[model samples]
Target: MAEVTYYTEEGLAKLREELQYLKTEGRTKIANAIAEARDKGDLSENAEYDAAKEAQGLHEAKIAKLETVLSTARIIDESNLDTSKVLALSIVKIKNVKNGAVMTYQLVSETEADFKSGKISVKSPIAQGLLGLKVGDIATVSVPAGEMNLEILEISR
Candidate 1:
């Protein structure tokens, strides 16, 4: 069974757009490549044809994976989320317990996570530790670098 993932409206829209592109323009481009490769020479000795077939297989696998994801995706309403504690789609402001350095992150699904844009995956160590925490609550997160303490400063939808 596929695990259901929650996505914001914008994230789901982006995913659908990508799937549509892959089904249309993406498939067309791959089909053209295969056709061109097949016209080159005998199938037995054609490396180009072999490569194109491999690429097509990979592309089809990607489409299948995306379709599965779409089938199990659930759109989350950000406006209805509780601001009292950290949760998925919550924009959380945290302060490092040791150095007092403040940072903000929006907890989102893996597909929507962009570290540079302050969006972190909900499965990440930091976000996992922050989950269910309220403002002023200190969470100890174990990261690859080591263990660190962070205090939840604010939570917003």
Candidate 2:
């Protein structure tokens, strides 16, 4: 069985929209490419036809993957979440123990995680170390550089 994934409503909507596009406009485009390639000449020696078929296969595979994701995706209810400790969708403010630098990040599902937007994947090393931690708790996380300590300053929805 596929692992169940948690997502915000916005994230799930975006996935649904992408799946719809892949099934509609995306499928139409691939079909047109296949038809145009087929019209070019004999199938046995047509590189364009082969490429189009390959593209179609890849596209179908993507559609299947998206379908599976949608099937297992569940939207989390922020209102019911506990704010006393870090959890998925919780916005956490943390301070570097060694440098005193502060950073805030929202722990989100992998698909919704965007570093530029201050959202980090819950599966990320830092997030993993911070999970279930409360304000004033220190988390020791391992990264590519080395291990660092981060102090949780605040937690919010």
Candidate 3:
């Protein structure tokens, strides 16, 4: 069974839009490429045809994977989330215990995680450690660089 992933309404809409594009314009482009390559020469010795076929296979695979993801996707209601502790979609402000560096991040699904936007994946080590922590709670996170301690300063929906 595929694990159900929770996404914000915006995230889910983005996924659906991508799927629609892949099914329509994306597929049409791939078909055109294949047709153009086929028209060039004999299939047996045509590298362009081979490459086009390979690209089509990969594109189809992506579409299949995305379909599976959508099948198990669920939109999370931000307003109903408990703000007492850290959870998915929670905007959290934390301070690094050693350096006193302050940072804020929102825990989101993998598809919606964008470091530039201060959104981190729930599966990330830092986010995993922060889960279930409340305001003023300390979290010890094990990261690729080393172990670090962080204090949760605030949590919000």
Candidate whose lDDT is highest: 2
Return the clash pairs for model 2, or none. Answer: none
Residue range 47-104, candidate 3, lDDT tens digits: 9999999999999999999999999999998888999999999999999999999999
lDDT of 1 by residue, 1-157 (tens): 9999999999999999999999999999999999999999899999999999999999999999999999999999877889999999999999999898999999999999999999999999999999999999999999998999999999998
TM-score of each: 0.98, 0.97, 0.98
Quote the lDDT for 34 in model 3: 96
Q: Write the per-residue lDDT of candidate 2 for residues 7-99, one digit (tens) a residue.
A: 999989999999999999999999999999999999999999999999999999999999999999999999999999999999999999999
Q: Report the candidate with higher TM-score, 2 versus 3.
A: 3
**Candidate 3 local lDDT, residue 89:** 96
Which residue runs of candidate 1 sit more than 4 Å off their true CA positions?
none
Q: Over 4 Å off in model 3, which ranges?
A: none
Candidate with more favorable, higher lDDT: 2 or 3? 2
The TM-score obtained by model 2 is 0.97
Residue-level lDDT for 82 in candidate 2 = 99
Model 1, residue 157: what's the lDDT? 88
* Candidate that would win on TM-score: 3
- The TM-score measured for candidate 1 stands at 0.98
